[model samples]
Target: MIEIIAISEAHVESFHRALDTVARERRYLAFLEAPPLAATRSFVLDMIAQRNPQFVALSGGDVVGWCDVQRLSRPIHAHGGILGMGLLQPFRGQGLGTRLIRHTLDAARAAGMSRVELSVHENNANAIALYKKVGFVIEGLQRNANKIDGVYGNVILMALLF
Candidate 1:
């Protein structure tokens, strides 16, 4: 059975472990390499400390995925929330992604956000499909928006309006 729960201090270690696995297997670090294990641990703890909620999907007590609505993107984009979502590779085809994203959207609504946005690498087909499956539409594509391993990758800007 899979369960989604509010992130708590007790879950930090498990969350960190899950993140490392995602980072290693998915090569999802277009923006960040898996940091030192301790740093990754602290980063999540600090983000939670700032009051943005984090949730983990657990299957039989093992962390399988997580999604977070990083609060308050910036001064100009204060009304918008940014997201970082991931699941273990083996868990990809199941409906876990849908459940995780829906949970984040509900959190965004509760936070009074009128809009939510995320940038996906243009090449990440599964993520694009999942985002579209959850009602996020592509707003635009940012050309040469990010450098990954010395190659420029376009970022597809996706949004969901509440």
Candidate 2:
């Protein structure tokens, strides 16, 4: 059985592995690979310290997906957060994305976040659709915003306001 739960220190390494797997796909996240383990550990610890919303999908004690909402640092923008999430290839198309995102977003809302935003590659139709289904709306499009492997792609900005 798959479970979605808040991230904890014990889950950091597995979460890093899951992040690396998705990032190596090179078709979704801006990261082509996961950052160093130390850096990832620090990031996760900081998220926990700050009470940011971060969750992971666990299958048999291994992380297969994750979702996080990072609050902006500036005092004026503190009410808002940036959302990021991903799942392993095998886990896609199984509604895990919806489950992960909804859990994280609910945590964000309960933590006093008033807005959550994200940017998706235009080619990532599934992600865009998922975000829309979760109350996010396209705010703008940046033409040729990303150039991966010498190919340019547009980026769609989306946001959900509470």
Candidate 3:
């Protein structure tokens, strides 16, 4: 059985494990390699302390997918939030990303967010399609946004305005 739940400090370990697994894929996430467990835990702790909203899809006590709506701390950008999402290998192609994204967006709206933004790799057709299906529109294209192993990749900047 899979459960979608709010993030908590207790999930630190499992979240770290899941993150490392996804980061190792080195395709979707920006990280080129798995980060240290301690660093990952600290990051999660800070996210919890700031009341940032994070949700995870769990099965058998392991994190299968996760999403976050990161609110900016600067007063000028407080009304804006950024979305980040990822899923384990076995969980893809099952509409899990859509489910996670929909849940996160709803939560963000209820939290009084005025806008949300996300950047998807330009080559990721499926992700771009999914974002479009969820009401996000392409606002601009970021040229050479990511340079991995001497190869530059474009990014599609998208947003949802309320």
Best-performing candidate as measured by TM-score: 2
Extract clashing residue pairs from model 3: none
Cα miss at 39, model 2 (Å)? 0.6
Angstrom error at residue 35, model 3: 3.3
Q: Write the per-residue lDDT of candidate 2 for residues 118-149, one digit (tens) a residue.
A: 99999999999999999999999999999999
Q: Cα RMSD (Å) per model?
A: 2.2, 0.6, 1.4
Which of the predicted structures, 1 or 3, would earn the higher lDDT when compared with the native? 3
In angstroms, how far off is 95's CA in candidate 2? 1.0
- How should the candidates be ordered by TM-score, best one leading? 2, 3, 1
Q: Each prediction's TM-score against the native?
A: 0.85, 0.98, 0.93
Supply the TM-score for candidate 3: 0.93
- Misplaced by over 4 Å in model 1 are 73-76
- Overall lDDT per candidate, in order of appearance: 0.80, 0.96, 0.86
Residue-pair clashes per prediction, in order, are: 0, 0, 0
Predicted candidate 1 versus true structure: per-residue lDDT over 1-162, tens digit per residue? 789987766776777777777776534544353577678677677767766657889877878898888777577777778888888788888999899989978987887787888889898898999999888999999998877568888889999988
